[model samples]
Target: MTAKLWIDSDVCMSSGRCVADLPRVFRFDDEEIAELVPDADIDAEFDAHRDLLVAAVRNCPAGAIHLQEDGVEVEA
Candidate 1:
């Protein structure tokens, strides 16, 4: 397991960049805003889509997404 990921909604621009990069890991709610799949455990899910997760973070213009490992910061 690597790290968990979280997106700060307050800083999110609703760009959907993360959603587009990782459709299986992200989604857009009815409001057309980006949202993580409920209860997602990114550390466990990392192996399958780490690339996409990284890509999402890289693509996010607001820089709202963050990754943490065992409660330690991994990405800002």
Candidate 2:
């Protein structure tokens, strides 16, 4: 019913692209890892900045970003 983004902790290389791209939706912890806010709406959480999310995933380098919709994984 809605869109979502998942970050693979293991694959994340701490590039901080997610946080820089979608600061409202993602945050960097002390360890420089990206953390997604729980229960946060994909639209609202990222301030309707879908491009930023897309860019983050595309430039992830680590291939840790996963986009999904309604419980189904969606290709970037």
lDDT of each: 0.75, 0.75
What's the residue-level lDDT of 53 in candidate 2? 70
**All candidates: TM-score:** 0.76, 0.75
**What lDDT, from 0 to 1, does candidate 2 have?**
0.75
Taking the candidates one at a time, how many backbone clashes does each contain?
0, 0
Clashing pairs for model 2 are: none
Error of 1 at 65 (Å): 1.1
The segments of candidate 2 whose C-alpha lies over 4 angstroms from its true place after superposition are 45-47, 70-72
Among all windows of 10 consecutive residues in model 1, the one with the lowest summed lDDT is 67-76
lDDT score, residue 56, model 1? 76
